[model samples]
Target: MSSLTMMPMSLEEIAQAVQGRLVAGTAAANTPVATSAFTDSRQIVEGSVFIAIAGERVDGHDYVPHVGAQGAVAAIVDHEIADADVPQIVVEDTVLALGLLAKHNIERRRALGTPFTVVGITGSVGKTTTKDLMKALLSHMGSTVAPVGSFNNEIGLPLTSLKVNAETRFLVAEMGANHVGEIANLTSLVPPDIAVVLKVGVAHLGEFGSAERIAQAKSEIIHGLVPGGLSVLNANDEHVAAMSAFAPGDVMWFGLPNGDGGNPAITAQHVRCDELDHPSFTLKNGDGEHAEVTLGICGQHNVMNALAAASVAMRLGMSIDEVASALSDVTTISPHRMAVSTVNKQETSFTLIDDSFNANPDSMKAGLDGLLRWKAGSESQPFRIAVLGTMLELGPDEKDLHVGIGRYALEGGVDALLTVGSASDASLDALAGAMADGASLAGDASHVDWVHDIDEADRLVTRLAVEHPGAVVLLKGSHASGLSALAERWQALAAQ
Candidate 1:
């Protein structure tokens, strides 16, 4: 987590890199930009460059004047900023310009003869967690630069890549895509020395149209690798394992020992979780030297993510023991991904598993599995409640997917279920209702409930907290569901 000293880019060099024309304050073209570029004008500093992206609601060009007045050296814009005091680099598309600038930055770093390794990671799910884990493991060897949160798209990847300087030894580039060619373009911007494909689940099935298409999109990272670059594949996922044929170089497998056919270069054995659901396992490498890793993070699904990271670190010359020690030291990742917390209300307290960051069918099941493993520290069983919301972008069979998750929860012995929906959107309401119907049909009707929105869901959960002290509540859904906001509200109240 050490702060990086960004390599300076002159305003003239920036314009040439992005293929833009510098206007307004042309005298400052030689000004050395020793800081990072920003899309938000509010984050502008003395030496930073501002990228004016024309978003849907708010036009970044409107803030050009404000950023110029705040001492920004230059701004990259699609159109000329006439009144702004800072120089403007006009390009056909500001986003593309941003990518080009980042590409030049990475290439310049390489030309300086400093040793650097860029690892590109993509998958239908588990991309963010694996990125976080890899960052932790790589940081042990040298200074590392990784994106904050799930910054995996064009803008995010470039912004993260721009943070790399002469001193940085590792850059964990998280790449995500909603359709075909997105990951390929991202990989072109920052071609990885090592590529990691975690799993090929139906995360963005609606956008990509089919599972095979999703696999093809995810494989772009493997095909985009540099010459002699190694690919890390998940042996547990057949779709991902099949990508080995597209790799330009060797492939390293990581998964459970019982996975498909090939022996995983890195695997976890004897996996178990405690009452709070934090998993512990024996970390084993292909050479058979093993180390015990008791992860500080919750969820059994993360074992695969840890192994994926271990494979990369071991390939980069870190010992198996070093990888295990680093993995054990990581207590949490980006917020709301199986983040466990204790909420204390007026007279009762409950365990809250906030996996409300984002979800698909695969991740929803993983969240419920973590909830089912939770214990309340008494002889009697703990009351388990799952508060799920609409999982968007699931395509024509979205209802069937929601229903399947609800059935999975009830059949797996969940005590209660609350599905959140939008009172304003009937389509969303129907999806939530479908989940309720599935749970009721699978178990007792009295245990299933569908609330119109987060507000109503909150009231019911509050009452349930008072009635069932020490209950374990799980909040999971897509980002638009606002479930993470609800989790934050409860967490703030608990803190107070």
Candidate 2:
């Protein structure tokens, strides 16, 4: 919030951008607007503009007087609030008004003729990690701003864009969708200079209905690029690579060599993991360019993420060595995605891989693979334990997907699999049990156990770790299953 300088917009420009008429207060059109915009009154600082949004559970209009008392200069509302003290701009829909304001702000920045650029990213997984990596790498070049967390939706996108100003050099936007046209709508707010499509997977199969629909949703990012902008894609994903033709500009691909006679623009070769699963590989760019790079994060899956970010950095005039050094400096920015921690209790000591932010078929397998590969090369041959929870939004074939993940664990050489979720929630409990059942079918039944709750799973994992010293345990699941909470519990106990 306090990094770069933010220019305030005039009230007249806000009215013209949203086509709203200021119907109240004695404020003149030339008056300076607020410092920032917000829909939640609790975030309203001095000189903030309150945009009233009526959501499913609460209405922002109800907080008008509260924010005004807290020093809000004006309010953008859909209806006239009785006896509202501050100036009010009435629009048809406040959400659309917010987008219009962001679009105008972007255009205004473009009109300044500065070296501002917008890079948009969209994918089923790895979007957040890639965004964090790009932000860290790009920061070494110029001023960069991105969303706080998973702020990739309609409301989140515009809020991030509102922070852009004259001195802003690069803006990294994360676009996400649950349906076909969601990304398209977000792209309209701020057209991108460089579009990155990570992968087209079934993360939201329930809402999208099919992987094909999900692919279409992901391609919207490419379609929304500005004229002659570049496209960075994952060559390993056929659905993603095929999107190149749809882009309005040239494309750059990143992935490991497929050995099908296709050389990606950026590639990682001779990939190796250390004792803690940190990957080191030779980075190869187009035109016989190569650099020996090492990553601080612990995941084979993240190698693809590194390639995507490095491709962007290279295209933006950064040398391969600089990109490698920047990437190597980053261990893990965002939490709960392959986040590694060492637990050194008196009774038990092991490493914990906390990937408990969210889960799907693709990410669950990726995390499990990382857990297996981490211990594969170690002399200790640590017992690799995967404590998995429910993967939500997998559609009607959820049972099959869970079973397949279980089989993946067994085939990937996981020594023990512990499944946990809500017991009272019959659907999730059954899903976790189904995962354990599938793993039991592949290996010894005693190695796979499904607990109906987190407490039992926590006790089981602690007991297992004490039983097998120096073991590596992984916690992977959606946020609802409380696997992240269990990880936090272990972290706090370790701190003590």
Candidate 3:
């Protein structure tokens, strides 16, 4: 919530530049721009533009009165709303207007001669992390702007485009998908000469309905790339591997241990992951160019994130040494997307792995992997745990996707499992059954640990901390479920 010394322009002036209209204003042409923007009415600030949008269940026109009170200088309505005189810049369609405005702004910015390098990234997993890596690597070389948080969706993507201007040298745009064609729409608004598609997984299965559909939805970014653009993909992910033929130009791949299924690119070795699995490794290309780089963040999965960013940077002419050196000063973002926070309600008694910021199958797996790494070689005797919440937005196939995470966590070495939320209830049962069956196979049936709620397990976690003295715990869930509250309470008990 910090303020920038940026000027504001009225909605009327923006309409004139874009060939839009002033529908109901006696002050149409007279209205000067206080600020330029493209968003629903709710985001309208003082002297700003309100893009009256229509989507899903609600129409933005329904909120024009509220926007006016919020100080929007003029309202841009597509179809007529029941308004008299708030100075409307009417358009054909507000959603399309949002993209066109963004597209237009990008063009104007480009004409300034120092067009920012637009690194467009989209996939099921690691888009945010990869975007963060790319942002860090680019900032090492020049001024960079990346989206703040999951600002990669419909509203977020257009909003991110507004941040691009004459001052921005690099803009790391993260694209996300839910249904088919979503990525394509966003990519067209800000085409990239260098596109990155990270790992694809069962992310929005609720919307896409199947993993194959999910993969197809993710592939939209490849097709939308600017001609002769480079495509950077995860060589390890089968979905990314399939995209080699679709890329318009050269395809560069990066992965762990360097798997060559007849195509060779770059590889990373001598990896040293911290308790969080944040990586510092030596990166060597098919050529002899080599350097040791460590991530500003941590995670076993983040190794790939760093590699993806490094690959794009190196191709764009950044030296390995510069990328490696700048990484040391970069920092990971928060809300337990593998963040280690100091905002403890308790003593610094336990580390909280908050994957609650966003969750899908792969992110859950990566978070669990980080937890295992943290628990490894620790002096804590009570063992590590996984607290899970429902991965919302996975429509009908939710049960199956939830089971996939449950199985991965059990196999990955989380000693105890704690599940919350109604969507994950079935996941809890399946995990208990899987653990029981595995225990039975080992000839021991009494050791499976499953808690019905976070409260029930809080005391046990406290005892684990007291007994072992240095217990590490993981708390992960979707943002909607407020799982961090449990993490805070658990940390409080451990502290006392």
- Which has the greatest lDDT? 1
RMSD of every candidate to native, in Å, equals 1.6, 2.1, 4.2
TM-scores for all predictions: 0.97, 0.94, 0.83
Q: Least lDDT summed over 10 consecutive residues: which range in candidate 2? A: 1-10
Candidate 3 local Cα displacement, residue 326, angstroms: 1.9
- For TM-score, candidate 2 versus 3, the one ahead is 2
lDDT of 3 at 170: 78
Candidate 2 residues 1-496, lDDT tens each?
Answer: 4432234776666877888987656754356466677778888777777889999999999888667778787889999888776778889999999888888878888999989889999999999999999999899999898988778999989888877877788999999998889999998999999999999888989888898889999999888999888999999999998898878989999999999898798999999887677889999899688888889888878899899999998999899989989999998678788888888776788888989989999999989988988857656698899999999888999999999999899878898899996878999999998999889888777889999888998778888898888888999998888898888888886677
Ranking by lDDT: 1, 2, 3
Q: Candidate 1 — worst ten consecutive residues by lDDT sum?
A: 1-10
Best-matching candidate per TM-score: 1
For residues 1-496, could you state the per-residue lDDT of candidate 3 as single tens digits? 1121012344554676446777654655475554456466655666666777777898778877666678766677776666534667778877677776677667766777875688888878778877877887887676777888768977787777776666777778889886798888888888887888888787777787777898888888888888888899888889888998889999998887744444336667888786545678888776767788777676877778777888888887787777777666667663356766422334335556656677776787778888888736556543666767667777675666666676666676666666554335665444434433433333322323445456655655555555544456777767655576776665454445
What is the Å distance of residue 283 in model 2 from its true position?
1.1
In candidate 3, how many Å is residue 491 off?
Answer: 8.5
